[model samples]
Target: MAATKERALEAAVELLGTDGVRALSHARVDERAGLPAGSTSNWFRTRRALLGGIIDWMAEQERADFSPALLERPTPETIIEGLCTVFLLETGPFAARTRARYALFLELAADDELLAPLSRQRREFERWTDRLVTEAGIPDPVPAARTIMALGDGLVLHRLTVDPELDARPVIERAVRALAASVG
Candidate 1:
């Protein structure tokens, strides 16, 4: 049962990423998940509930991907590597998940209610980045963190959509190194 729910959510996310929010329906999710008909509706009775579940699932996946261990060491090398790993989407599953997340973000831009959780998640991530910059002895952590985040978002979006062939590691690493050096 738990597995079925997870599969349905995963399928929903994939659909959102590939086909946008309008394509998301209980039947569609069931079909994408390869579950029995009405399975998604059984799990998530309403479209709102289904979207909320997707958001929760995305948050969980992101928490795992950006584990504390990854951010424990705030050295420029670690930061650069971490940023590269996340923005580059070197893995297939991670890339797909990220694409879905970006798609959801666009859809949620005008939806304050749906964007609330994601907004909190964004603030949390910024706080983490600020802490990392402070630990690195950067005098102005806030601006540095914001800059890093902007650079990361730009790179990730570009990599995901604009130019799939664009190589992001070197660019991200160089930017992080420069930002750290400027403040050091």
Candidate 2:
């Protein structure tokens, strides 16, 4: 049962990411997952349920990819390196997941009920960033964290949608250095 659901969600991610929200449906997921008829619907009765499951699954996948050790003792260099690595993954190897996430971000923007779970993960990340910057000696850690997160998100979006080959390391380094300088 769990395996079936996992396959369904994985297929749903690929479908939603590669083809956009319009391409998502129980039949498509079932076909893509190679499950029998009605299998997807058995697990997810509605489109909303399927979407929510995908959101949770994606959050889990991303969390697993992001190791806590990377930012354990955040410094400007570590932060820049971490962000650059994340940028590369998001725009390259993990582009499909990024696209799926952005699709959900837009599709669920007006639906608070559906958006809440997605936003929860983002909030936790922001809190983590807050702690990271604080540990790095940023006096105004909260806003700095937000700025950093926003900048990273924007850069990833641009890389995914605008240019797949954009090298964002220099931009990330400059930004991190500026943030660090603000403290000194």
Model 2: per-residue Cα lDDT over 52-162, one tens digit each: 888999999888888667778898888998899888888877888889999998988999988998899898888888888889886678888888999999999998888
- Model 1 agreement with the true structure over 1-184: per-residue lDDT tens digits: 9999999998998898778888889999999999999999997899988888898888888887787678686887878877777665523457767777777788889999888888888888898888888887665678988998998888777767788777777887787777777843
| Model 2: worst 10 consecutive residues (lDDT sum) | 175-184
How many residue pairs clash (N, CA or C atoms closer than 3 angstroms) in each of the candidate models, in the order given? Answer: 0, 0
Alpha carbon lDDT of each predicted model:
0.81, 0.88
- Candidate 2, residue 73: the lDDT equals 81
Q: Candidate 2, which segments miss by more than 4 Å at Cα?
A: none
